[model samples]
Target chain A: MEILNRTKKEGDRTLLDDLAQKELSRRKFLRFSGMAGASALVISGVGLTGCVRDDDGSGTDGVNLGSGDIGILNYAYALEQLEAAFYTQVMATPYSGMNALEGEYLKDIRDHEIAHREFFKAALGTSAIQGLDVDFSSINFSSRDSVLATAKAFEDLGVAAYNGAGKLLVSADYLTLAGKIVSVEARHAALIRDLISNGSFADLASLAPLGANTANALDGALNPPQVLAIASTYVRNRIIANNLPTS
Target chain B: MNVHNLLHEIENVDPEVYDRLDSRRKVMKRFSFIGKTLALAAVPSALGSMFNKAYGQTNDDVKDVLLFAYLLENLEAEFYKGVVGTFAAIGVPAGPAQGALTVIRDHEVAHVAFLKTVLNSLGVTPPVYTAASFDFTGGNGSRMGPFAAAASNYGVMLAVAQTFEDTGVRAYKGQAPRLINNNDVLTAALQIHAVEARHASHIRQMRRNLASGSLVPAGVTLQPWITLAQSGIDTGNAGANAAIQMSYAGEEVVSQATVPITNIGGAVISANEASEAFDEPLTKAQVTAIVDPFVV
Candidate 1:
């Protein structure tokens, strides 16, 4: 099949376009967007630009997550999808006698996750993956114990994913921004854990095991493969091999 | 709208195109010599400037730091395990403090296990052992070992434990950035690091409650932000150089020191010396020098 000879349009718009195009790589991309860049993902494909076509009973067609920054955007997109799904489920069927405070807290979590998901969608633009169909078969959302347990798991896992990936970011600015987000994730983990067990929150994970800890083992924590596996259930779109750093 | 369509779209696309695009981007990103030099020059200072930034050691030069982190996690896990076991065995006195300490100990074990898994997945063999010598319950370096019974000086021991826990929080924060590319590892480590910070805060609060007055015990340094000044005395004289006296949140908080987690206890600490409550990373030379005595 012949590749389309897409013509480059030139004008004052082209100057902005050229600069925007230059900001497609991981480090350079964040340099251009700062914290806001998370919302400006550019999609690459044949026909679909950034529009999320409201298809009849079907997701929009897939877009190419171009190399580097595009790949990172998709990675984030996948995570946001997972988080948004989990939180949405949590809000849908809260545990028995779940207080007004708990209700508000869970709602806040759902909102944060939606924001993160939407940010990736906007940032990836035409390149972003369409909405994923997540499987929640394993979770008994009706039970408070089950929901809280899952939330704890996700909150902890999200924090860990961020921690492991922060060093992988080539951009200092992006790294800084990720740090802020990870800390928030960690706070979420702590709060959720505390809600379940109260004073037992800090100790339940680290101190009971052994050694003079002498190192931080708290906050949210997870490595990549672990996180990917946990998140895999929600992301239906296959991640294209984009030559982003994995190790 | 649905999973099947998303998969079908993915299937229709050529994976090779993604590969080609990715490689092209990487080739473009590869350094102009000027860019390479500038990045290298900026790295050390940028990483060093903040605790969180310090973990952003992503380049090839950071293998040592990564290895050090692995070793540190191992050492910490072992320490907490020993404490929990000892407390359980005695079946002596149990209270809220002991209960909290026990939970923290369990978390440490999980952390150690988690980090080990990360290293294993990475195909990196972590340092097998650390010198298991610390005077946590005060007898000498080797006196109590990791699981020695809580002594009459439980307060002092708790203070030291709290200090070490706080230091861990800072050290992990310092190491976060370097793992950004490895989303899996970064995520796991961040989870544990946040837990450590909470542990530190709890311990610090306990110490404050115990003493009632603003005075902390000798050889104990609360995080820099928590002052001993209310008790009518300056606890330390490191001046600007103090480990716990750095500015955080626009205030001179307790300096969250970022020493290599492993080396801080086994090598740099003298049995009698106050555990230097500051972020002092031993240079490779210093680490080698201190570890030489214990290494076979």
Candidate 2:
């Protein structure tokens, strides 16, 4: 599990600098796991494990999450695909009683999600995985309650997924890109939350803050596994993230 | 720091010999030096004048990022606290705007607490900027700006909230790359980023709910998401358009990877839809420009 992954910018040194400074033989490895989603554990005196791809050599044919940063990008891309498909359906058959303004918000978000999905596709080019197959059978698109509820869930899940994955990216550009998209997802999340229960947008309890939070000051942050677990219910394909970096 | 000059000596060495040298320290030192030089040369010179002394901190890069966030969050928390704390004094009744503002205020307070905790844990003291440090009315010392009615009026108040929250979202996105090396910081900033986005969205939603007569004239039309129309954002026709421009200046970006999305994706989205779909980043300079007026 990821321990002390929460950096304590000790004076002038960062955790990454410390890790890089340490001698080659005694490497400190960080694995993100615990506290349901946002905790990271630092492990020492061991070989990095559980990072080999589960795919059969060729990564394209199945749910293979390449490796390293590409794997994380693909993970985000996959979620965007799910969101885009979901919104496309929502617009194609809007639930009853969606006003022009409400309908406009949904349409803007749908375009944004589609842009997001395709941006990753262009950015990744060949490294991108096959288009994901979705399962929306459980969601009743005709009902506002069902559509809004499902939309809220997806938006919340997208925000958390990025929160957890931000630590895994090695490239600064990609990290910035992920940050750019995640906030919009949050905006969508807030709108959907408001659409459901007027003031519930930021009312949910957040465990992200350190110390006691009397105001429940933090927000949602889901690890890849936790997100995939929920997303799996909506995605029909068998997703495998074995090659993702844990340290 | 020239790579060619640095590699001259190693060019003659066999691959096997270079591998056995175990010179990780030397290599990292050169790499870091190159990174520093690149960072300096990369930032556009035209944007340099906008930098501020308020955020000038010399600590771990991540520490600086956290403190910057603390400044913005403080500004937001105080803005909300003033109005939400004195709902009646401001001539506003308890309604949806009041309810929405309360929720946003709480989130801002939470964000401030979170940033301070992270700064403390980083072994750095958080800078304190009291609410008196701000001048929301745009009137320093002796006068109040046109938006002084912001607190007294729900419509004006929502306009101010929209600018602050949108800037907050962009500010977080801008600093994320600097904190990327530290996963904990990156993840935390992103979490806050999304919350700010939610704030921006709800503020827009609230504004949209206002009666046409009570609406904030932001020049151009407004939506919950960003779009590529700056005609009204900077036209000064709306409430303090000049002040609000820094927060939303170039938000109307319609291109990604130097190519239009609608051209290739077959989505058939309009030009407005393209920019509305994505939020752009803003540097500390742009943020301080929009925020400093409120911050004394």
Best model number under TM-score: 2
Q: Across residues A46-88, which tens digit of lDDT does each residue of candidate 2 receive?
A: 2122122323433543476654566788899999999999999
> Clashes in model 2: which pairs?
A1-A41, A2-A33, A2-A40, A2-A41, A3-A40, A3-A41, B133-B296, B137-B145, B228-B252
Under CAPRI classification, how is model 2 graded? acceptable
Please count the clashing residue pairs in each candidate, in the order shown. Answer: 97, 9
Give the winner by lDDT.
Answer: 2
lDDT of 1 at B185: 55
What are the candidates' C-alpha RMSDs?
14.8, 10.4
Query: Interface RMSD for every prediction, one decimal?
Result: 15.3, 8.5
Error of 2 at B145 (Å): 2.6
Q: What lDDT tens digits, residue by residue, belong to model 1 across residues A94-138?
A: 778789756866766665566556545544445565676676777
Place model 1 in a CAPRI quality band: incorrect
